[model samples]
Target: MSEVERPARGVSDLGELLATMRPELDPDAWVFATAAEPLAGAEVTVVEAEGVTSVLRKHDLPTAGDAPARMRVSPPFARITLQVHSDLEAVGLTAAVATALAAEGIPANVVAGFFHDHIFVPWPRASDALASVRALQRDAARAGDARG
Candidate 1:
């Protein structure tokens, strides 16, 4: 008997999904599409496109030789990842997360990856955002998606 390929699981339940996904925030401040590509002496790099990169590094000034082209490193942000295998075709995860954060007056800049969705919000408000997201999960698990 030929073994059939197991399909990737995609969650459509807003409440159940969020309830289990352990979202986390990065401690270091990260830059958004500003650093020069192929940067040396960096801690983390998110993306490299169009000769620029969004990098996460220690809170230290860059050397003149490695300075970013244009940086707006203010109101430092934190990265939160939904630890779940999310389907790209799946609808409403992004909207739901954003909406929940918005309800707490926390702005969310979402980036959807193959296996997960990421939200970047103000650094100081990261805890607040995390709490809000967790609460959303609880509400969803209890209410089964009130967004209908």
Candidate 2:
């Protein structure tokens, strides 16, 4: 059996990349922070930042004003990952993705990591955002295939 090409990479063709990579949203809510290290067990975003040490825990993590981590996003945030290996400098990907979400009145916080683009939409509207993203992927695929 031939292996299935989930997300065709190296195309760099924004349209094709968006079409092939079916972005999936995680069920558990997530958050971001400039953590010196990864949260002990929580699946969170931790990056190297020059400052006092910190950790990326869920919103439930105790914090207060004057705390190194002043901001605490409650109700958490929904995380979605586009499985395409888009280059860091890739143009139009983030814009297009954000535009789609915005059109549906869904706010998206995009985080461009090494392998894929992570989107954090409001937890309440996460399902709607996922639907919008899936629709965009389907439409892009249809358009790309039709051009052939």
lDDT (CA) for every model shown?
0.71, 0.72
Model 1 off-target regions past 4 Å?
Answer: 1-9, 13-15, 33-55, 58-61, 68-74, 144-148
Candidate 1 lDDT by residue in tens digits, 1-148: 9998867877766556766677776777654535446455544455645444444543654666666666544457788888877777777788888998999899888877667887888877899998888777777666664554
Error of 2 at 48 (Å): 12
Which predicted model would earn the best lDDT? 2
Give lDDT: candidate 2, residue 96. Answer: 86
Q: Estimate each model's TM-score.
A: 0.70, 0.71
How many steric overlaps does candidate 1 have? 0
Clashing pairs in 2: none
Candidate 1, residue 62: how far the Cα is off, in Å? 3.8
State the lDDT of candidate 2 residue by residue for 1-148, as single tens digits. 9997654444467887788877888877665544444334444454445522222336545455434443433456788889888877678888988999999999888877667888988888998998988988999999999997
RMSD versus native structure for model 2: 6.8
Residue 118 lDDT in model 2?
85
